[model samples]
Target: MYCYVSEVKLVSLPPILCVHLKRFRNDDGFTKKLYDKVTFPETFSTAIFAAGQSENADCLKADEHYSLYAVVVHMGSTMSGHYTAFISSNQDWYYADDSCVQPSTWEKVQGTYGGYRQRSGETAYLLLYRKKSWNSSG
Candidate 1:
């Protein structure tokens, strides 16, 4: 009989959190990229991951939250790809692809969630979130 236990906890929270998604994998000596739709919320709560005695545990108990502010999107396969970014500024959204920048919408941002097929247009590679102020209304 074998028993395995895994434990993880957060010791502290930072003002800014960056999340990287694993979109590539090596199989049988071949590197391939995966196009999978991963849904993320505009606002995320970290309270569930807080350790009991972690720094600022009180903030977690009080429902401290983070808001998504930016996303890095990757297009193409593992061999080569192009990168773009969707950024939120003062409640406005913009898409930046190389030297081109244009105003965008939340709907457009959501489109980067990727698809369930190989070579699917764009996929979110990185996500950036900022901790909401304690006094923030939302």
Candidate 2:
């Protein structure tokens, strides 16, 4: 016997995509942080995530790709933590931590992937992706 798994698909995509990950769990009467490793690419197509996407719709084009542009990272535990942001634009990445802002790299952003011994208390909680625009005049 085989079991079928049902998956929810996106019917329409927005110009901007914001993804949020649940990094907290409640056990009994206490809450704890989860450090699961969740990796994502810089760019991806939304067609695979869509159900019965119209082939002729410009918005449904398989060539359409979204690029990761920003991330909101949370550091420390649920009781005491700090928030920071990593932003990418003009081919440059920057890290904003309170009053400090400096240049960063994709490698640094990848560090947000929480797991054992990998930036333990620091993790990405939110992500922002923007769809690429294509010129029709060609």
For residues 71-128, write the lDDT of model 2, one tens digit per residue: 9999999899999999997868999999999999999999998988766598999999
TM-score of 1: 0.84
The prediction achieving the highest TM-score against the true structure is 1
Q: What shift in Å separates residue 125 of candidate 1 from its native position after superposition? A: 0.2
Worst-scoring 10-residue span by lDDT in model 1:
53-62
Task: Pick out the ten consecutive residues of candidate 2 with the lowest summed lDDT.
Answer: 51-60
Per-model TM-score, in order, reads 0.84, 0.83
- What digit string (tens of lDDT, one per residue) describes model 1 on residues 1-138? 999999655555788899999989999999988787888877767655654555644434436788889999998888898999999987788999999999999888888887775355699999999988667853
Which portions of model 1 show Cα errors greater than 4 Å? 50-62, 117-120
